[model samples]
Structures are given as C-alpha cells and as structure tokens.
Target: MKIDLFITCLNDALFPRTGVAMTRLLRRLGHEVRFNDAQTCCGQMHFNTGYQKEALGLIRKFVADFRDAEAVVAPSGSCVAFVRDLYPKAAEWAGDEELLREVRLIGERTWELSEFLIKVLGVEDVGASYPHRVTYHPTCHAARLLRVGDAPLRLLRNVRGLHLVELPAGDQCCGFGGTFSVKNPETSTAMLADKVHNVLSTGAEVCTAGDNSCLMHIGGGLARLQSGTGVVHLAEILASVETVNPAAVVEPARFSAEGLA
Candidate 1:
C-alpha cells in the first residue's frame, strides 16, 4: 500500500530519526511511503491555545499538503489527532464553509502511525527485531483521541527478543500538554514527576510512547534528576533491531534515544 508521510513539525525539528525509523519500519513491512516537501505543522498548538484563526491557516496548509495522498501517516498521535479532530472545528469557528469541507476531507486522510499500521495494514508483526525489556506509554493523543487500543502492544509483543513490561498506571497522561508545559512549568513538572516515578517503578530499561511531545517532557524530567529509565518514541522501538539500534538512530540527547533504558 502507498502512503504519504507527514513528518510532523516537532518530529522534524526535534526527533527526525523517529520519522526515519517510521519510514524504515513501514518499508520493512512492505509499504511504499512518500514524503511531501510542502508538508508542515498540523497546527495543533495554535488550535489548543484558542488561536482558531491562526490554526485555520495551518488547517488549510495541512489539507493542501496531504489532501491528494492515497493515505496519510504521521508518527505523531498529537498532530494526527489535531488534524483529525480539531481542524474542522477551527474551520467552523472561522466561518469558512469551504474551509470546513476541506479540513474534513484532509482530516479523514490523516492517521496516527500505529492506527494506520494496525487498522489499515492489519498486520501486527513488521518483521523487526529488538533485544530489550521495554514498556509502552500510551500517550494522551494516541490513547484517548486516536484510541489506538492495543495495536501498539499487539505489534510490540511480536518483536523478537522484545520483553514487554507493564508500566504502573501506564495509561495515565504524562502531563505534557504541549504549550501547557511551557505556560505551567511548576504544574507540568509536578505532573511529570508522577510519570517519571511510574516509569522508574516499572523496572524496565526504557519507556516508549507514541507522542514525541510527551516523551520529550518525560525524558527531560527523567534526565534532569537522573532517573534510571529513559524515554523513547514508539516508532523508534518498532523500527529497532539488534543490528540497527534506535539508540544509534538518534543523537545529541535532546531528542536522542538516550535513557531509552
């Protein structure tokens, strides 16, 4: 199956390797993936902050970017969720009839990576290998908005030598609400503290999550105080193998696969 890749703005700037790993994993599963130069932000931040007008411009850009693809795939649940759920609302708020139609049309085409893999491809095993004991953190976007269910676990369970560990209260939000983190640092850190504690208690080497935003926050807090468990994007884990470690796929430790336990 042919699919267009939406390397979200966050992933593009912070964790480009996660995007690359996504492509590698998809291709290894025998899917033809395409990337568009015009692809840009899904404008999740602007919409969430009540900047509906500004977000409308992004909605139009997102639609224009991926509207013609056979299918659209993004390694980000947050961005994909915004595109799928909020774009039309933004359009409506702007009182643009044509924009609403366009937003809805594009939103229908966007899919979070895991959702596209399990729902559209119907395959759990992508024939990837990884030797590690890892826990999966169900990000708010992928869990609640995308409601990807056990698609990630279903796929991770099939990886060779990959031990899936349970993260206590793993489904709880990591408190990284994008702009919410910056605006409410103390609150964000307080919330992230619980998430890190849960991760540490898991005894797993690494915690993998769908949203890079959450992982970034979780990983940063875990690193600042030197928490043992590290954070990694789910796409990285899915794309990882013994020979090609997702750890090496990243660098500089900012978005790097460090503390990926």
Candidate 2:
C-alpha cells in the first residue's frame, strides 16, 4: 500500500526526527511511504483556538494534499484527531457540500501512527529494541479523542529489552493543548508540574508519548527540574532495529531522510 506521510507543523519544525523515524518504520514494514512537501498544519491550531473560518483554507489544502493516498498517516494524534473530528464541521460552517464530502473522504483515510500500525496493518511487533526503563504518557487526543486504547502499549510490550512501566495518572492531560498552553500559562504550568512529578515517580529514564507537543511540555519541566529523564516519541522506539544500526535508535538526529522518497 502507498501511504502519505503528513508531518504536522510542530514535527516539521521542532521534531523533524519523529517524521523521519515514522517514515523509516513504515518502509521497514514493506510499505511504500510518500512525503508531500505541500502538506502543512491540519488546521488543528486554528480550530482549537476558535479560528474556524481561518482554518477552512488549511482544511481544504490538507484534503487536497492527501486525497489520492491509499491511507494518510501522521505521527501526531491531535492533528489526526482534528482531521477526523473537525474537518466536517469546518466544511459545514463554510456551507460547502463538496468540501464536506472531500473532508469525510480524507478524514476516513487518516490514521494516527499507532492506530495504523496495530489496526490497519495488524502488526503489534515492528521488531524494535530499546534497553531502557521507560514510561508512556497517553496524549489527550490519543487517549480520549482517538481512543487508541492499549495499541501503543501493546507495541511497546513487544520491543526487545525494553522495560515498560505504567505511568501514574497515565491518562491525564500533559497540559499542552497547543494554544491552551500559551493562553493559560499558569494553569498549564501547574498541570505540567503535576505531570512531571508523576513522571519522576515512575523512576523511568525515558518518557515516551505519541505526540511531541505533550513531550515538549513534559520534557521542558523535566529539564528545568534537572531530572535525568529524557523524552522520545513512540515511533522512534518502534523504528529502532539493532541489526540495521543502533545509532539511529539511540540518537534520532542520526536518522536520515534519504529513504523518505
């Protein structure tokens, strides 16, 4: 199957390695992965920030970008949630029936990375190895919105030499609701502090999540507190192949986009 990679705005700018890792993992599973530089934000920020009218253009662009793909996959759960849950609303608000039809079609084909890996592809183990104690933070969209229950954990459990621990309050928000973090700094910081405390309590060396936005928020707090805990995306862990090259798994910066064609 040919898959289109929708590297969300934050991943493109702040966490390019996540996209690169996702592409590597998809190809490793014997699927052709295609990257369209034309793709941009899924209008999630605009929709969440009450800029629905302004988000219509982006929604249309997103629909147009991956319309022909057999399946559209994204590493970010929140962005995928936006397309699945809000694109139709945006089209309705614009009173564009044609756009609404396109939105429904595109949204049905979009999948969160874990959802696609476990459900669509029917594979729990991607043959990964990460020898470190780690805990997972179920991002809001992945947990509540996307309802990706146990899919990520099942994959993690299959990784060789990886010690997976349950995070306290694993379902709680990491306080990184995109604009929510910016608009309500104090509340966001307070929530983040509680999350950081829980993460530290896990005694895990690394904290992993499906979304970088949550990881960045949780990671910043961990860094400020001088904690030894590091943050990694789930895709990076799954993309690791000891035989192919251990460096790519240990250091995401070593990930090359050469195979992302």
Which candidate number maximizes TM-score?
2
Candidate 1 Cα deviation (angstroms), residue 181: 1.0
- Candidate 2: which pairs clash? none
RMSD of each: 4.2, 2.8
Query: Tens digits of per-residue lDDT for model 1 on 1-261?
Result: 888888888887778777778878888888787777666777788878877678777778777877788899888888888887877778778888998898788777788888888888888887767777788889888888888999889988988888898888888778889888889989888888898888888777778888888888888877787656677788887887754443333553222223121
- The whole-model lDDT of each prediction reads 0.80, 0.87
Local distance difference test, candidate 1: 0.80
Per-residue CA lDDT of model 2 for 1-261, tens digit only, reads 899888888888778788888988999999998888877778888887888888988998988888898999999899899898888888898999999999999888999999999999999999998888889999998888899999999999999989999999988888878888999999999999999999999999889999989988998999888887889899999998763322223332322245475
Clashing pairs in 1: 129-241, 205-261, 230-259
